[model samples]
Structures are given as C-alpha cells and as structure tokens.
Target: MMKKIILHGATNCGSSNFGDFLYGVAVYNYIKENYKDIEVGFYNPSEYFIKYIGDCKISLSKSDMLIYIPGGYFGQSHKSRFIDNAIQFVRFMPVGIKAIFKSIKIGVIGIGAGPIISPFLKYPIKMIGNKAEMISTRDNESYNALKSLGLDNILELSDLILALNIHNLSDTTDQVVDICKKCEGRKLLFVHYNHSLLARDIFARQLDTFVEENPEYQLVVGSDCLLSYDDEYYIEFSKRVKKNCIQFNYDSPFELIALLERVDAVLTCKLHVGVVATMLNKPVVCFAEHPEKTKRYYRQINQPDRCVSLYDTSEEEMLSILKDKIFEKSFVPDEEIDKAKRNFDVLNELINKK
Candidate 1:
C-alpha cells in the first residue's frame, strides 16, 4: 500500500501565499519525486483545530509514512495571545496536552525558519526530537541552533526556494533568453511599488530620480511587488519609467524561473521575490520593511555582504549599497545542496525504521 503523507500548518494560512507555495514546491520535489508509492494530502492545522488535531490527521498517521508539518510545537504561553495574560494560559495547558500526546508514531517534516531563544523554538525543538521523524529547517544557523539544543533527527536545509525546479525548462528559458536580448550586457534593475504600505511613496519617488540619474540601466517589476499592478503609485512609476520597463507576473512557475534567471540585479521588498532572486544568483538588494528577519536569513546563508536594511536607510545610502552588491557573486553551491539532500534521505530512513 502507498504510504499517505499530509502537509499541515496554520502559521502559513491561505493568505500567506508565498511561504505556503514554497513549502508545496519542496514537498512536490523532494518526497513526491522520490517516493512513487507515497500518496499525498495537505491540511491546514488551524482549520483542523476548529474541530480537533489527532482526529483530523488520523488518516495521515495511520499510513506507513505519515508526514506531519509545522506542528503546534510552540506550546501554550501567556505571551502567545493578544490577551492581557497570554503566557500563563499557554504554558500549563499546552504543556500538559503535549506530554499526553507524545506517543503517536508518524513521519514529520518541519519547513520554516526558527524563532530565536524562547519557548517558541524550545518546544518545537523538543517535539521535533521526540515526536517527529525528521526536521528540516530553513538555514544552517537554525540547523546548528537546533543541534545545540541536542536535537538529533534534524538537518540544515536551504529554504524551500531551493526546491523550485528551474532545470529542464527549455521553452520558458527561451522566453527569458529572448527578454535578455534587449539588454544582454546591461544591468536590469527591479523596483517595487505599492500604496498599501507606508514606504511605497518614498521608494517610488527615489526610483524616479534613480532612473533619470542612470539612463544606463533598465527597470522592471515582479509579481506581488505591489499589491496591485495598476495601483496609482505603481501606474505612475510605470508610466514615467516606460521605455525600458517590464512588469511581469507569470502564473507558471517555470516561466517565472526563466524570467528571473535573466535579471542582473533586483531590489525587492517582497520576501520570496528577494529570496528567489538570490536563489537564481541574481544580485539582490533586500529593501525589507524591518530588514530584521531578512538580515537574519541572509546571514544564515553567509551572504551578509548582499543584505542591507531599510529600517533607517536614506535614498543615497540604499543606492550606494545597491551598486556595491550588484556585481558580487552570491551563489549557494551544489555542495551545500548535496548536503541537504543527504540529510533528507537519511532522515527518511530513520523515520521508516522508527
């Protein structure tokens, strides 16, 4: 019988389109490709919790390889809720519930970044060691952090961004190649615009000045770069920067990969857009809202030189930093990828035997 697998999480609900989609890509590529006898199912834990946890996922666990995802490891805490007293609430009840439910035998895979130092991570780390089959986190620091906590069945894997298949995409690659022909040697820079956010005005205004200052480069926009492509601010930016501007949103993953492969440089506010651009080895300027999480992620990958903060950055500071990083090599290697793959494979064996 084919083993049944379930991917479940509430941290990333439907509204969290990027991370949700990326996790899907990883499952599709990793387990689905390798295990033909495995049948897959996806679930939303928050939705499942509306009724129950163990019952909702019982079918998944009953199979030979039950794949629990992003489990509710961050046990109950008073700080967990917006209520006046969050920690006291979560700590006692959740801890007791977790202790009671620790015996289920199931294959587990955790796909997300780690929280710093707290019960937030501590519980996940504990459950991953106790209840899970294997845990695959987003970066090396997280992997090391979990290991320091005495975690055994864990691995430092690349972000799900690494799992997206860009190889064997000839026709879409041709489209990207055709797009590249316009400015094969010249740099193609992307600027994000949106009115829903506070910094869009500042970013767009700076971009206008930037375009006038540097006629040598072309500008572009990627999907979700703005809340809407036709938002007034973006529309004006697009109009003023028309001649060499491209606003692209390809629904197909293959086409998007091919499109991004041709870019020389990218300055992005969207999280996955920056991450995916970095994955393609395109020079990236991460104009993050806080740059807190983004910097942590970049540092985890050993690409700090390519990261910059928008927290207190002036237009001039951003422009200068953009120029400096644009020409540098920021590629994650095949060796690193191989290591992640090895860890993933070994984890499967451990889970099966257990």
Candidate 2:
C-alpha cells in the first residue's frame, strides 16, 4: 500500500514566507516527479494538529514519515540573544543530546521517514526519519549541521535550484523592462547590496556620484530593494538629481542568467546571483553580507575574491574592481558546476527510493 507522508517544515516567523516559497516548491516538485502515486501532504504545526499540541488525542495520528527543514516543526532559534539563543541551541541541538536520555524510546517502527535539513528537533523526530526507508539533504552545510546534531542524513550535495528554474520568466519581458527603466545607461551595472552590509545608501550615493561624472555607466537598482516598494520610491530616489539610475529584477534565475550574459557585469548582494554568475563565467562582485557565509563560499574555490566586499565597497573602488574583473576572466570552472549537477542527479535518485 502507498504510505501517507508529510514534509512539514514551515513556520510563522519573520522569513517563513520566503522559506515556504522555496521549500514548498521543492517538496511539491519532488512529489510530482518522483512519488507520483503516493499520497503526500504538507502542513505547518497549526494545520497538523489544529490546536496547541499538548497531550492531544487527534495529534497522535502519525504519518509514515516526516521530512523537515529546521526551524519549522519547532520554533525559531533566538535571533541575537543569550538566553533565547541558549534555549534555541539546545532545542535544535543534535539528536545525541537527547539520546543520553535512553529511557525515552526512539525508533522507526510505526513512524516511517523524517529527514531533516537543520540540526534542531526531538531526537525521536530525527531517529525515526533516519530509520526510514530513504532520506537525503541538498547542501553540505545542511549535512554537516545534521551530523553535528548526531544525525548523518547523508550529504546530497544538491542545491535548492533542483526545484527552481529560470526560463519560465522569458515571457515576462515587460516586467523586466518596467523594472530596468528605473536605471538606464550603457555599460550599466546592477548593484545589490546585502541587508547585512547596511551600505546600500552609502553605495547608492557612491553610484550616484559616479554616474554624475562617468556618463558611460549607470548603477542600476536590483529587485531585492523593491520589497513593499512602489513607483514613488523610484521617483523619490531620483528627485534629487535630473533623473534616478535605473533598476531591474529578473523574473527568474534563468532570466537573470540571460540578463547576466548580456550585461557588462553584476555587483550583487545576493549569493544565488554570485553562484549563477560564477557558473556562467560572468564577471561579478559579491558584497560580503554575513561574514561567515561569505567566507565559506569564498574559500570553496579561489577567485571568490573576484566578488568584492562592502568594506571595500566604494563606488569608485567597486567601479575600479568591476573594470578589472571585466578582464580578469576567472569564474568557476565548468567541472565544478557539472559536479553540483551530478550531485543533484544522485540526490534525485535517492529521494525517489521506494
């Protein structure tokens, strides 16, 4: 009989919307492509139990397995606090922390699968998933995170991109154009400063000054800045000068890929853009957002310095850097990209296991 399963990594926190958008799409795609006939469903905790899950009878109905990304089934970790972070650390700590309490039974008899992406959960939650017929994760970070939590869910080395494709936005040229018109000029460059960088206005002012002199290049705003924005922002940002620089948002990564191919270069705050640009061998600069995350990716392969950081993120400095990279010519190699693709291929096979 086809087993009923649930992949329930969802939250009611600040960025849960983004997580929902990303993982929801991934899980749905996995179901569509691989587990075609199986009965599958997804639910946030509230939907799962309909009430606070404290000794409730209806909440006991179990699924064959529960696949999750961290920070969903449980609550979020503390943002930047000592006590909160401590509680979060333990709650999300590896399964071994709880394993010491052997009196608590842990196994996958009635429960089926529970592959988790992050290192937080009840030990039985992870143990059951690990004992399931199959399990996997996309990135190495997630794998290490799980291992640290005392669960070796196996590093699938795939990317969330397995569920996201960009070409779907080709027909949305008008949307792209509407966004691009916000900033316009030959040799135009798009600069997306990371939120952690807090240098958007600083960079914007620098670009503003550079555009005043170098009529050849106009620094365009990227789509990320448009959150909860309206046309008035463009007008307001441009009111001080004759007109504002233009900006654009690619409808999808594929469209962004196509745009990157046509552009002189990209100065991005987003990591995915850096990854895609590197994969395409396009000249790009990544402003260091979270120092740790940037440092990690930077070391993954050499040439990551090709993408400059906000510390050195002056417009003049950035322009000079772009000028250099426009010619430096060292993006990621095709072999590395193909390896990632192969990892995803293997991951897909694993997820499809019966």
- RMSD to the hidden true structure, all candidates: 6.6, 8.1
Model 2 — TM-score against the truth?
0.61
Tens-digit per-residue lDDT, 178-245, candidate 2: 54454454665666553432546545555566567766765555543224453444444455434356
- Top of the candidates by TM-score: 1
**Which pairs clash in the backbone of model 1?**
76-90, 76-91, 77-86, 77-87, 77-90, 78-86, 78-87, 78-88, 79-86, 79-87
TM-scores, each model vs. reference: 0.70, 0.61
Q: Which regions of candidate 1 deviate over 4 angstroms?
A: 9-12, 15-19, 44-110, 116-129, 144-152, 163-165, 169-187, 192-199, 224-233, 236-244
Model 2 scores a C-alpha lDDT of 0.45
